[model samples]
Target chain A: MSGIQKNIIKTLLLIALFMLSENMNAQTCCAAGAPIGSYLEIQTGDKRLFSFQFRYEYNNVNRLVENENRIENDPRTRYGQSFLWKLDFSLNKKLAFSAIVPFVHQSRNTISEQQSSFGIGDFSFITQYTHFKGRFRSLNISAGIKFPTGKTNHRADSQILLSPDMQSGTGSFDFIFRSSASKTFSSLPFLTSYASALFRLNGMNNDFGSTSTFVGRQFAFGDEVNSQIGARYLLTLKSGFLTPDIGLKIRWANHNLEQQQAAPNSGGYWLSLPLGVSFAPNEKKSIAFTAELPLYQKLSGLQITTAFRLGFQINYTFQKNKTDDILN
Target chain B: MKNLLFLTILLLFGCNKDDNQAQTDWLIPFDEVLDGGPGKDGIPSVDAPQFDNVSDISFLNDNDLVIGMFHNGVSKAYPHQILDWHEIVNDDLSDISYALTYCPLTGTGIAWDRVIDGSKTSFGVSGKLYNTNLMPYDRATDSYWSQIRLDCVNGTQINKVINTYPIIETTWSTWKAAYPNSEVMNLTTGSNRNYGSYPYGDYRTNHSNIIFPVSNTDDRLPAKERALIVMGDQTKKVYSIELFAEDRAIEDTIDGTTIIVIGSKSKNFIVAYEKGNLTEVVAVTDQLPTIATDTNGNRINLDGTIESGPLQDVQLTTFNSFIGYFFALGAFYEVEIYE
Candidate 1:
């Protein structure tokens, strides 16, 4: 491959790696509104000045587990789908801003009953600062605020306020912190490795489940930490580059507090493997598909865990300067 | 961009409300019945439970609580460790079939006859709760019954009362000693569960660990305090276990009906019987099958069977009663606490 072809291949691999790592943070269960992990914007390389991306995520939680043991006979299942739109604008080589808007649809099913909710979910605004940029490596840190744009008071058909887990929004303003880094090997310029970590400080919803007879109570989702490490390789094709990636993701959450007491079946640890493939038609656009499978899960109490997760993403970028290379 | 905006608007407004259209009529307030996370049969019921003789069982700790029942000269014990996970156990003894229903959230256990409308049917957890108490539904009629209220709260059999069998809730050591030949529900329940573990952490003992709000709050005692509550016609009274710390029986009246409550904090049990003719009943200690006695030397066994005296072989009728957490009893009824 020529030098320009190699550069395009590296950039494509990095984009695929970042996309795979960013999408690995979808919450396992009982998360209010859109998953906080979906707020992490993809790290579009310095060549792109602005980018718009849309992702569709489907998560199925049907595995009932107690600690580390799986209860095979539970019929309770929950399915969540989120449509996320993200916009990223780079002001300079070292600074960028991102905004994410999500629409969420959630449904829980049992043998006798079914409950579902759908609406606009929480929104996140983030500012990222590039800490270091080298020939083969880059580091970026970001901080953001999550707005309580979703509705927490969505009621069931019986006119009862749905539980926090079933609601479209948390009704609380939360804070998000994230950092990501990527590196390419000197010998293998077509392969890129990346890692990202995120921490979410959850806020409380004071008006949860308010009724005529009883006042609203306080509910807070547990704080969470999600981190992932992955590697992606690019293959040059006749029309585009095909990038395949794999990663290990770890998610840890503290027990949720309802009325200031630890809620049972609320928090746990999960380790999963995310596999994905991306097709970049050119430097300005790409499409990717990913699937996450749980390798190990240890929840606090008896809980329904995620069986698998599937996600599809499309990205379109506006470059600061146009290149006339065949690969572009 | 137009299609994206249209799709966004459609998803934002088209399917926002989550409605369960099947629930039409409810005897209680519909909004008060909260889904307890798990769905129907999510917390599986032990349909055909295996039992081990008291001497053959080895999994129970001395202080582990068990619900003891006796019928046709046969005794059986259901440990709290097992009940915390399964919540219901349907068992059959000869012609008698009953479901041992337990709610860890409310700390209450009551045995109800599986026969509803002259038909035999088992009960399953509805995965719904009122005042944080278990709401069980009968499989025959698919009707939901409130365990604390002992009445069908919803479905086809709404407002129907369920017949309850008296069960003795006591420590495992006390139960084994009282009925050495009793059969205890074993761990081979066919469900893959950690039977030795308590599913709800610190919920049983934490005074402020109530996950759901109660309609009525009685601040007279701590929320999680276990007490025996006797239900009468429009009247209910609670006798705390602390009142029987010294192993005594007290005669009390509820709506003009006389009753005798016998208990001991050390033994971790409280039992009550209708005071028909026997008088001056007093609690006893370390006597197997003999928990109380009257002035006429009538030996009252744990199951209320009179072993001797003028009422020999006659069983004392028990009042409608069960042990429950203080908060649950207060939330469901206007209960008067006996000092």
Candidate 2:
């Protein structure tokens, strides 16, 4: 117990030191290093503009059980880090093109289980076309194709949590498409809301079954895609340096097979309240960060959770004058 | 302009500044809400939590499924159908004692040992359970019950705690009643408007004057010969020493403790003097080496202070909408434990 306490103190000290250093270094987003947000987007704020973004994110998840049970570990923790780069260019005023590629490095292993596990996750590619562009907002429909970049077969020494299905990659092609648009508020304080609906057409993969004990691993299912609706309120503070954003998102997807077998289709709905702030250093350079909390997910045998997202944005100003003209 | 940027930076990094007062609401405590307990309905739920898939492996022989670890080996097949939905249904059968675990969130299924019969074993999920992963632990408690910072426990506000209960039922009304004084920070996340909406069991309103762990109380006396003491509002015990002795009170013993009866109906509870300390409570399984961990997986706090702030509130209310069902179903991954 004392050791635990000491470790806690050490962790706090480390955090304090990190914070202290962070203050001394003002990391304003630049083209040099991109951390999971807007850095690489080209001509993002204008019509007929080119854009790209590179993102890097780290996720830490742990599931612990109380009561020592005096038994070996029954908990699992996973740290997943990802690198994503995206490119989007408006082919013309009415048509647009976009692509996203992701690279991931993760080890799904457990110390208590005395088992070591590693794998890569599935990778995806997306392309889209703008069907319409309104005076205040524009609409684009995109088509996405995903490749199975993950390992379907993974074995370990002892027991662990990294399952084949849970691998960082899925070795198969999943076709998807989406339509997205964003409109800034006409009100005094800057407020903009965006909405997108994405669809997934399931692909065939032979890696799951024969290696798994799950039912769906035997046969491929039909199409499955997630439709997400989100809206954000960004209040451009009088100073314009800090803009706080409060957003809400709801997602619906089809992922359960047994229930689907029962109802030909059984899906789920997730409600999340995203709260964060956006920082604009100059008129053309800005960043938005948000935290996503799971409000409610009606499911069984699952622990309630609170998940969050921290995003940053650095828009590239190419042909600044033309971009400004487009915005006007 | 740069000066303004400095001020915004200061506001963003601040932590734990305005938190001082603690809740004193007598009606219901905040812990009852932030800390979850067993739910009302144990078996099935109205939401009909989706069960992804099921596979019957009863045909596998012991050699195919069982594996040797510390002192004994485990043959991992049973009640797979029941586990398909509940994920964590515990039972002691075939002389095999284990707790079933499943994460509907990640759709991962795995089993844990309650009392290791022979050897200590640390097994991971098969290639199937995707969302199913490892847990965090500390030496003080068995790694069995601890977790990392973001780990999810069975029934706790922080989403991380000891995993014991399989299902956790949360409701906004009950939480509000539990902490009426606390503000409703997020009307959407949860509201303080409703209370007592727990579906499984109500908060324990009636506690014995002398409950478990607490030593001095009238209820501890033998029922047969014990006295009934009631207090108005005086804070002090009005009738601390009331005696109504009966024949059985002195002569009989229930479950080893001497019983004392009082009142005509014998309806009054019993009391007994400490006849020697109660039997030693069984310690946590001591075989496995303990790993240091905190409730949230950081090292335990030395001063026993709360590492994270008080547990936050979880919204128990569920909402649905159109087009929400087109997604959320399908195979995410597979987990195979037994052969």
Which one wins on lDDT? Answer: 1
**Candidates' lDDT values, in order?**
0.81, 0.31
Residue-by-residue lDDT tens digits, candidate 2, B250-322:
2223334332211111111111221122122111111111111223332211111112323212111111100
Over the stretch B106-208, how does candidate 1's per-residue lDDT look in tens digits? Answer: 9999999999888999999988888889999999888888999999988889989999888999999899888999899999987777778888899988998
Candidate 1 chain B worst ten-residue window by lDDT: B14-23
Q: How high is each candidate's TM-score?
A: 0.90, 0.40
All DockQ scores: 0.31, 0.02
**Which run of 10 residues does model 2 chain B get worst, by summed lDDT?**
B319-328
Question: After superposing candidate 1, which stretches have Cα over 4 Å from the reference?
Answer: A1-31, A36-39, A42-49, A153-162, A318-328, B17-24
**Quality of candidate 2's docking, in CAPRI categories?**
incorrect
Q: Clash pairs of candidate 1?
A: none
What lDDT tens digits, residue by residue, belong to model 2 across residues A221-249? 34444444455444445655665655565
Candidate 2 global TM-score: 0.40
